[model samples]
Target: MRFVNDRDPLPLIEQLRRRYQDQRQIAYVERAGDAVVIDFTVHPAAATQGCGGANGTGCGCSGG
Candidate 1:
């Protein structure tokens, strides 16, 4: 996920950790003028479960 805002990213990261049960990690960050962009990557297993279509069964959308 990408967060575009002027505020610090720590709060956002904390919030995401709580939301995703600490399965999220910060991949990187970029600065765009006054806004900061935060990129995150969730654990593979968590991603698959969150997608709700494991093996392309439910939503017909593969998480792979």
Candidate 2:
């Protein structure tokens, strides 16, 4: 299946939702005061820290 690139938030969000569905557990959205939070509350140990993009092995974590 081919995924069409959506520049908008909803489609992008949904795409990510499906991608991590099995491995990551729950994914949801909520209001975090002034800003919106797209919570990717994942499996704690499974998630790794993002690479600084210098070493090139970015762990695909948030900071990356």
Candidate 3:
């Protein structure tokens, strides 16, 4: 599990998902002030523990 901070993570995440497909695991994103924080987990077992969808839905973990 690692955190990647970006002003906009959608484009990058989309590209990554397309390039890696199922090889990549869960991806969670949240708004942090003016920027978006993206958390990417490569471990398949961690997928179930991840929050949010590929479309960036169901993300209440940030308290936003």
Candidate 4:
């Protein structure tokens, strides 16, 4: 997906990287004036199940 913001989202992107680890990826697409464009993608195979089972909480606990 594409993310457009008035300011660079570098800090948010870093947070996402830490949260998703190798499960997701983010790229800087472009910069125009005060607008910043980013590309965020999730690897499909890594998203089949949640860390909290199928509940999608990603809490890294068993039993949803």
Order of models, best TM-score first = 4, 1, 3, 2
lDDT of 1 by residue, 1-64 (tens): 6767876677767766655554567755777667777787767876656543323344444543
Residue 10's C-alpha lDDT in candidate 2? 66
Candidates' lDDT values, in order?
0.62, 0.45, 0.59, 0.71
lDDT (tens digit, per residue) of candidate 4 on 3-25: 99999977887777776677777
Give all candidate RMSDs, comma-separated. Answer: 6.4, 10.4, 12.4, 5.0
Candidate closer to the true structure by TM-score (higher is better), 2 or 3: 3
In candidate 3 the C-alpha lDDT for residue 18 amounts to 66
Q: Which candidate number would show the highest lDDT if scored against the true structure? A: 4
Off by over 4 Å in 3: 45-64
TM-score for all models, in order of appearance: 0.49, 0.32, 0.46, 0.66
Taking the tens digit of each residue's C-alpha lDDT, what string does model 2 give over 1-64? 1223223246666665555543344333444444444444456544453332323444466665
Candidate 1 colliding pairs:
none
Please give the TM-score that candidate 4 achieves against the real structure: 0.66
Model 1: lowest-lDDT 10 consecutive positions: 51-60
Steric collisions counted per model: 0, 0, 0, 0
Backbone clash pairs in model 3 (N, Cα, C under 3 Å; residues 3+ apart or in different chains), count:
0
